[model samples]
Target: MAEVSLQNLEKVYPNGFQAIYDLNLDIANGEFLVLVGPSGCGKSTALRMVAGLETITSGTLTIAGEPMNDVEPKDRNVAMVFQNYALYPHLDVARNIGFALRLSGMPKAEIETKVGEAARILELESLLHNKPAQLSGGQRQRVAMGRAIVRDPAVFLMDEPLSNLDAKLRVQMRAEIARLHRRLAATTLYVTHDQVEAMTMGDRVAVIRDGVLQQTDEPSALYDSPDNVFVAGFIGAPAMNLRRGHLRSVDGDWTIQLGHNRLPLADSVLTERPALAGYDGAELVVGIRPEAMEDASLSDNNAPRIVVDAELTEALGSDMLVHFYLDAAAVDTGDPDVLDDLEDAALMIARVDPRSPVRSGSRIELTVDTKRFHFFDPKTNLAIRS
Candidate 1:
């Protein structure tokens, strides 16, 4: 296993299209790092650069403290698992897994031993003799992974490897891959557009947007304390609710004015966020997570509360997602990448208990965990309260 580091990495095409801009990141040895963003956000390009498949326009890339800018892909000692599971239809599973070793003229006995071990680990021992035509989609993907595992490379690069699988199989393979990482402890850099996969699979996640590195941190930290508006809205399931509101000082108390309602700020919120005190009478973007907003019955009165008419309700077995709109003008946090979606713009979802009796068009009181509220500067879109 080896640590991968990128210092001021950049990728500019001859046609003048810039795919990545000053991307600086470090993947620790044996760490599973995920690079996630929306489509065409330069995630795959970054991974390809690290794999030595794309030439760097500027900056340096180091693997295990060695400069690899001029290294060939084959000499980089990296294994890549592609999304399409590029397996040969004519080759059986055993031969497919040992193809790399075979090309290197490894002994037949050693090739068989390594292939057998990888097959057993992936639970494909029974299908070793079957060709790609005989295997299921999931099985073929496993074969691709088996091929990578046999190489024992310094780094593992997986580019949307689970995109072809069905939903159920995708979840299953996610767990399996996590287990494989724990067992092998291989340095891995996974690229995907799926935020859920980024959150659940990676030990650390780097969020990119418009070819720019926005934020990189652990899943929980990224979700809980996003560095900017784009990250705050992109990392969560229902995403964070962001609306434009003015902070006003009324009778020595700081309160937020939203439409016709005013919600008082908690003492803890002001105590922890001193910068918020300066924003009095200033417009700011307020972010509230679905989990942070609860039904009136589940609300603790000490926290800030907002009462709105439920626009829609979706009962997803595990929890209820209550969607509603506020009367206030929506904040233009300047993160076009996140707020560009109309569906996310018109509605704010609150995760509630399945047993909650809230329904569409009904007036429901929701509490915003004041301590968890995320404040962002309306102009810069950067989080004000860390």
Candidate 2:
């Protein structure tokens, strides 16, 4: 395993389209870093650049402290698992996994030994003789992983490897991959559009948008304190509820006015984020996480409370997602996935206790953890925290 570093890496197509900007990242030895973003966000392009499959327009790429900008893909000492599995139909599982070793003229006995070890590691020993047509989608992807595992390269690169599988299989494979990474402890760079995968599997996640690097941090930190509106809205499952509101000071106290409703801001909020005081009388984006809101009837927490009519309700066993319409207009965070959601500008979602008896069109009182609320500049879209 080796450390990989991208120092101001860049990629531009022949058609004068820049696929990636000046992006810089460092993956420590044996660390699994995931580059994640939406469709056409240059995540795949960035991974390809690291794999040497795509040319770097500028900057430097180094593995194990050695520069590899001009190295060919085969000589880069990196193994890549593509999205398609890319296994030959005629070859059995063992042969397919050992094909790279065979190309390098490894003896048949040694090749068998390596293939056997990888097969055992992947639990594919029972299907060593089976062809691709005889294997399930998850098994086929395992074969693809086996092919890379036998190489024992300095680094591993995977590009949207779970996208081809069914939803259930994808979740299963995700767990398998996480376990594999823990056992192998290889320096791996994975690319995916799914935030769940990024949050669950990676030691750290790098979020990109429109060829520009947005934010890179651990999942919890990124969720708790996003640097900008884009990162705040992009990293969560239901995404953060972002709405435009005015911060006003009334009688020596600050309060956020969302359309017609007003919520008193605690003095501790200003004490923590002193910069927020400068936004008095200005419109800023307020981000409310769904999980931070709960059914006011269930608990007696000291959090602020609000009452709204539930527009929709989805029960997921563990929790109930109550969708309601607020008076404030939703803020556009420049995320394409949430564009359609903004059609109803006032829609907001809250995740409440499953035991709460709330249904669609029912008026429910929701409590919000106001101290945990995120505030962002309306013009710059950057978070306002000191």
Best by TM-score: 2
lDDT of 2 by residue, 273-363 (tens): 9999999999999999999899999979877778999999999999899989888988888888878655544578898899999999899
How does model 1 score by TM-score?
Answer: 0.96
Give the lowest summed-lDDT range of ten residues in model 1: 330-339
Per-residue lDDT of candidate 1, residues 1-386 (tens digit): 89999999999988999999999999999999999998998988999999999999999999999999999999999999999878988999999999999999999999999999999999999999999999999899999999999999999999999999999999999999999999999999999999999999999999999999999999999998999988987888877888788898878788888777788888778888888988988999889888887887765566677788889999898898999887767665445665687676867789987778898888888887767788999888999973
Model 1 lDDT on a 0 to 1 scale: 0.90
Q: Which stretches of candidate 1 lie over 4 Å from their true place?
A: 332-340
Clashing residue pairs in candidate 2 (N, C-alpha, C atoms within 3 angstroms): none
Against the reference, the lDDT scores of all candidates come to 0.90, 0.92
Cα RMSD for candidate 2? Answer: 1.1
